[model samples]
Target chain A: MFRIIKKSLKIGVVTGQYQKGEPAAVPVVPEVKKKAGLFKRSFAIREVDTGSCNACEMEMNALMNPVYDAEQFGIHIAASPRHADALIVTGPVTVNMERALKDAHKQTPDPKLVIALGDCAIHCGMFKGCYAVTGPVERHIPVDVRIPGCPPRPADILEALSELRNGRP
Target chain B: MPEARLCDDVLKVAFPAIRQNAPVCAKSSHFVVPKDLLPAITHYLHTQPNFRGRLTLLWACDHRPVRDTYGLYYLFTLEGSHHWVMLSTELIGNDRLFPSITPHIHAAHWYEREIRDMFGLIPQGHPDLRRLVRHEHWPKGMHPLRKDFPWDRVLGRQQGEHHFRHIEGEGVFIVPVGPIHAGIIESGHFRFSVAGEPIMQLELRHFWKHRGVEKLFEQQTLIDALPLAERVSGDTTVGHGLAYCQAVETLLHLEVPRRATYLRTLFLELERLSNHLGDIGAMCNDTAYALAHAHCGRMKERIMQLNDRLTGSRFLRGAIRVGGVTRDIDNGRLTEIVEELNRIQLDFSEVGAIIFANASLTDRLETTGILHERTAWDHAVMGVVGRASGMDCDLRRDRPFAAYDALPVNVALYRYGDVRARLRVRGDEIHESIRLIRELRGKIPDGPIANEPSRSPDPGDWTLSAVEGWRGEILYMVMAGEGGRIHRCKVRDPSFVNWPAIQWAVLGNIIPDFPLINKSFNLSYAGNDL
Candidate 1:
């Protein structure tokens, strides 16, 4: 648990990206002490594969393993919406899978963060503005973080979620 | 004397329905056969000794001249020969009816429904033409491939397919799985009619998220269209790009320099390798065979790292341009790429030997999802999947394209027609791909990475192009009107044809083995859904 948090927080500190949306300009919000992010690292994540080829799924599976060590950080990905605090949605959401994806997002609790994992999720990366997909993640729900890799490496996804916990700069 | 001669005579006997002498100027040997004689033509073609007339491909493209009109294309191939035949028909009137060849080519089942859903064409005698790759509530008559179907319709799509046609008996119960499924997959409804756990009937519903790729092609410029093609199926990104780019090149008659061909060849192989890696792992994962899957995942990761080294993108998008590829490898990168691929292939050999040696994996796979040799011929499925089912066909070897023409593709053959066969064939092909990639690494020609700077194509010209995609032969037919604004574009993925065989394969097997059977083929749901 300490490992994932530290790694994720370190990525945040390094990249200096604290939130999902890439902000061009902002009023200096005070560096509020995030007690919410500090301890008890149990994250309820909801995964929505937006018409992915399923490589993202395999990468997600890696995070569940010992090497990527996501479980150690209390970043628990739940199957149910009621329990989810973070929604992990992959991109290029096909025309066919769009609705259920939206419903799942709406079902998640408030103060929830959306992690747009994989290049397809970030800007519809490879699929890039295709017909079936009219979304990067923002088109459908409030995407709080963008983990960009063709499939973001497991480390990247873990890092994005951790940074979201601390809030964006 | 033989069935080949007899089939030729039958082709003559059938007369106009099977056009024996159409204008061959289209660079295709086969005729535009009618849907009615598909069975007889294919049946006779298969029976001839050494005839090797394999069913090349069965696909649908909404070759629309107007907003609501569309046409279907079914392409055929000779078993070992390079020649091919095509059958086409316009989907007319409100009903949009066409004779289903499922009875003849069993492989036509899923494809027919896909045509039904995507183009709103009805296949007569289709037995069960409920939405194969569409959600029920996708709004009837709004086929995604049709020209007029709006793109914005995907946002608020509903579960319109819940009330499917079913058989209600004293104890028959209908269990409808989600447009939203349990795990990480796109939305599709699978309604199973069962007395107990034994499924009597199964219907796979999809199209909850239909973005109308074919229809929308009319609206984009060629450069923009390449990205849309790449998104056809994430697993087959490079393949789709290759197909589309190849078509554009053909239209422009621009020769891709040797280096570009070599680079494109390398990326194509890499794309195949990565997807195969993911497929094998996912198949095993689905079948409760995690040990082998994990190792494959590791091997896949190595392949991805190689992709990152060669091109900046893991998926290798933007790696391909209209005439040639955008990315080029330096000699050092080439050496490293070959060395890394060789190492990965070696590790894969260890993994392959282990998986093949394991009796449990084979037991579950062999004869588990049997798509009989006869049925394989009937549907004219393409790529590794068809070849495994006793169909000796590969576009690379039979109809040479890219740097593949230089490389003698060792087309892997498997007659088992089951999940194990598909797995075994993929394993064999991976080795072949590795060998090809290594040999072509240093031989790349010296030239510009890409050329012909971008330009628009002329209107009123229609071109038909197909490439040996990773999954199989992908057919793309493009027609543009009003000075290349785009009249219609029809794209076909092999998964559209292969999915129905799953229903047949799962029938006799106990319900528990459905996952293994389904995973063996591992046809892309989204690829077909589009």
Candidate 2:
């Protein structure tokens, strides 16, 4: 127990603050902020992996790490869709996961924003023409934001979430 | 004596039915065996004291438009030999049936079921011929891997219900979990049959993320399919990418530069180090040791950032190409990597000491989930899981690839076969990986990063490549088609073999300990589903 406390103290605070007007930062718009009424102060996201290669999920998990510490920005990954303000969906939406994705989206309350989290979710990425895929997330449900990368880095995901909180779409 | 020749002599005497010998690629020898003789040959090779062969891969290919046969290939790696033996059998003339080897060899169970789902082939005398890859909604009579089925064809869904094995007892109840999980992980379902607290039985329903990755490879050119291979499992980009590239190089007889070989080894070690650290942390988090999780996560982040600095991608994607690596590491960057790894090594050792010293964490991990050696062997489990259960198999040491042939690797083995055993194996392997990277950085030769293929591979020419990924052994069997297109590319992630072992591991353990056991294995759903 003493060792644990010592290690914790030695590590200190490693979290970094997001800089203003960073390259990953989205431009804040007034109209977007007006629409994000309940999500203005804090954002609770529920990440739904439709059929990702798992890199996007790794980055998402990294968001909770000590370095990223997404909780510091008032962002938390909710345990369920009902408690979530937005749904961050990844992957190309395979046929088997189509119903589950739609169900999760419907479970989230009204005024909920859906963010397509990766290149696969945005445009199906490299898995564009595969038989089992049902295309990008937009094909099934409405998408409010799209973060593009084969898998966007954790900082990129954090920036996107900050934009969502600040009412920047 | 050459290992292949020794294997050939033994096989020739044991089974005279072995037909013409096909061309050998790398350390692998190919032979065409009669369909009837395949089961006996495999059974003999597996049980023989001198030649204890492990079934590495079993995949079927639809060979229409050129030949009127559906080919089934069985690849085996022998004990104490670096040689690989692949036996090919043909199901010809309107008969889609092949004698099942699952009854005799338990490891072939999932492979036989997968062959049935992908192709319309029927394995005669197989006990359970249920759908392995295809979900219930997939239309009946639709085998997506057939030559008739187009890569982008759309199909209508049909109503079908998956029957879960029910155990009827006084206090038994079934707990069915997700195709969509609560956590930010890949999607797969698990059904746990429980009585009070202890789990009676566990059935895993995976393949919810099957994206027809192999069929997609058919539509891509040889060079264009590297990204698909990289994405087979996101965490195992280097493993899958290196396997695919090595297979292609062997088929085309391309010579990789010595520097690129060492670089591939370096990048692979880095990938292994990052994943092992993350998994060690995840296991701790599952055990409610958040402090270890935090420090390990920080160390993993540093490794990932180093990967980004050396290569463009964080997961070491795009680092491997057909003949060699995509980029070269300069001397200064190499020095930086050595220094960073040294710092991480020190930090990891400190964290490791603290975590192991904590009675609460070690008690939770000690005997929570135990997989016996017999069960692991029956399932042909590979990588850390296999090593934990006393299966003496490490593809890097057993069958050397890249710079592994020159550089020695100390395989980490443990006999406990519990969660603690798996944890210890990963921890040991992390240190070993760091050592390998430091040694590789010093000895890396100076040359071009990649080499052009000498010529195009002829149609139907194929080869198998195996790499020891962070998870385990990742195998890729690439067959070339007309004009340098991929005819059939069969990918076997270690998860495909190791996933079933989890069910056996969680037998007597409590339901709440399932996640800790599952996290220890850390099998890839996408890789398995694909």
Candidate 3:
């Protein structure tokens, strides 16, 4: 709707529901490289909201928007925990949400990567050190990365997912 | 504060409109009126008050047969600063059919609907008392809030696509939008009956996202209640948390230090400023006003930056406490806030000028969602939504608490009761908020931020606290337990009453504008879902 940018002969741009795009970043697989094993291109992500303000939900949805199109990065939010190679958890794991969080963490396939999205999940941020809350996600499930924001923008969420998918620091 | 004097010449002159109870001016936290007369009390409130007697607040209720007595708890904030009263009436849980005040107060119609869904208490005389915040698949006998209702009852009930019925008529088509859609706000369905571009009627079916927040809050201790409050609606985090903390504080009769109070007010306004900017942008975006909406988005991000600077978090998280606020302000921070508020006001003025002055924007918004002035008063609407439509109620100006008493609260009013007026009021409020922030900084007392009150709230003490937040008045009713845990906790977000009004407001508007109209009110899904 915004016509701010000058028109261009657009390349093959993707549009539609639940379609996967080319992977933006592929894993290095350093150890596999030493053994001469090829790195996998596809990534499976599991999304869980331990407890959130739902703003994180906003950014999560944003990732799938026409602009960012998280699927364009070959990262998909998987339904079953068993299929996920990485966990994208939001909110400050509250006492009530701990069991489910740990359960999901356990269910994820081995060689799992954890990305704690938003400040609430990383440091418990504003909700830190509360009686009802059990964590900043690290207290229950080990986190590979912490994306800070009351909620990070969609780009930030995508960045976290892509980083974890590639097994990057 | 006297029963005899409460009925002076002015009270006597306005007395007749309906049933009258000499308000038991009880020295308790918050205010109340008896429950049996809930219908009559709201009706009487409509007629008697001298000031804007339109707005009313309905909190949570305890609808259980305890010793053969069921109590319905609520708080009232009369339009204009006339009265703030709390009411509780005992009823037999099944005899819970209290007469609906909706027929009298248009707003009570929806509030009654929600209470029925959650508590299984019918609102007698309610025209359409169907569920407002629950799924259609939700069980008939399962009242989620009832202490006895187990958590499993809502598990499978939460999943599945909702069923919506269409009306068979010539040129009439039903557009069922959501239960689960693309965007990530929270799930709810809006079924619109449209003839061409114009909407014939709209029925909102929600509760897909109801996570049993209220049930969890009841089990939570006062210290542990913050997480639930934070998740009610992410956008208005600080605003609602402060309201909850104030309620618990009042129940214990604790005094928040002035410094703590000022900081709470500061954070509240900052949250308000950011939300309004974002909302104004979204409203423009809804109407295809891309330039104006994007400009506002830029301003909003700046406000978020200001939030990150002043408090370590952008959404102003965990800034409130029961006795006082959590964070402290430093000298350099005070200087930064003054500059940030000034810069925000400057950018805000430009967006306000462009939107209010533009013809295209007004053509889309003005009179599109016309919530009648009388209808607004009948619902006892609060905050900017009520104020814009001439339903004069703002808790800070009327019912003073925190730093609102020390500074000025310049309420913006518009008579048009249209989307444009709502837009105008929001811009005016931003200016006023900027002024309020300036004033608070100037007069802020330099001292230790908090004092831990000596006493905790006693068991069986039924106290309610209500504050005017960005959307409207948020009321919290607390019934303390033996230890630190809460026996019953009710958080009444204004959207519980206002969302249904949208059903009426959207009756005649075109289908395209419903989202825009709803955005102006901007009621929280999670707030009501709780």
Interface RMSD of each: 7.3, 1.4, 8.6
Whole-model Cα lDDT of every candidate shown, in order: 0.67, 0.88, 0.67
Q: Model 1's CAPRI class?
A: acceptable
Query: What would the per-residue lDDT of candidate 2 be over residues B225-286, giving only the tens digit for each residue?
Result: 99999999999999999999999998888999999999999989999999999999999999
True contacts kept of each: 0.31, 0.79, 0.13
**lDDT per residue as tens, model 1, B387-471:** 7888777878766778887787898999988888888888888998999887886566787777774456666455667778778
Ranking by DockQ: 2, 1, 3
Task: Report the candidate with higher TM-score, 1 versus 2.
Answer: 2
Candidate 2: tens digits of C-alpha lDDT, residues A1-169:
7877887788788776322222343453555545565676577889998889999999998889898888877788898999998899999999899999999999999878888888999999988878899899999998877888888888777766666565332
Candidate 2 segments whose C-alpha is farther than 4 A from its true place:
A17-32, A167-169, B2-6
Residue A24 displacement (Å), model 2: 5.2
Residue range B1-530, candidate 3, lDDT tens digits: 45323533343354333233444323322323345556765566567644334435554456343355556654455433355544455565357677677776675666667778777788788877556555454445666666667543423333335455567788998887744332334445689988888788788875544556667676677767875686677887887788778777766778788899899899888888887877788788889887666567656666765676666566787778778877799767877888877977876675576567777777898788988887676666667787788866677876677899898698899977888888888888888888998888888998778777677767766565667788878877677776766767777788777877787788778877877898898887667665
What residue runs in model 3 are displaced by over 4 Å at the alpha carbon? A1-52, A57-158, A164-169, B1-4, B7-41, B48-55, B59-68, B92-96, B150-168, B182-184
CA-only RMSD, every prediction: 6.4, 1.9, 8.0
Highest lDDT: give the candidate number.
2
Q: Highest TM-score: give the candidate number.
A: 2
